[model samples]
Target: MPLSEFGDAWPGGVPVQAHGMDADPFFAGEGDLGFARQVVESAERGELFLYPGDQHYFADPTLPSYDPDAATLLLSRTPAFLGVVS
Candidate 1:
């Protein structure tokens, strides 16, 4: 659903998390970063990570586009972002 439809129903102070690859063909990474920036501006809590020259499914080890270094960094950051104790 489009963010415009949320209106005031959107939860306030919710953390937004976004990860994107600069070379992703399925989606524009710059656009993703822009949206993340908007969310961070409004919510004041979020993280946006972009891997340069990576494609879609870069984090999936089974995929040919897998980027081990990027995926490892993503894995480490995800837990901290979510406040997970692991």
Candidate 2:
């Protein structure tokens, strides 16, 4: 896609995390995982890329697909992934 045209634009690399499910049929699709993988593969080497498995937006406590375990792991790892320490 157009992303291929912007290869030089991502000199710093990219970090992204998405709900790993097609819960929102309108917004999410099976292609998401594939796209994420493509992004990671295409990114600069030795940079950071994270995709917490099986985690989705509904992973929050009040949501329907709320997965406490997955949420916990995702939340815990996000900071380090972003290189944020406090």
Best by TM-score: 1
Give the count of colliding residue pairs in each prediction.
0, 1
lDDT tens digits, residue span 1-86, model 2:
43465563335555544435434442245455455555555656323233334435645798776767766766776687678988
lDDT of 1 by residue, 1-86 (tens): 33455553235767777787867755454465555555555565766677876587888999998989989988999888888996
* Model 2 TM-score, all chains together: 0.58
Lowest lDDT 10-residue stretch of candidate 1: 1-10
- Score each candidate by Cα lDDT: 0.70, 0.53
Quality of model 2 by C-alpha lDDT: 0.53
The TM-score of candidate 1 is: 0.75
lDDT of 1 at 3: 49
Stretches > 4 Å off in candidate 2: 5-10, 16-29, 45-55
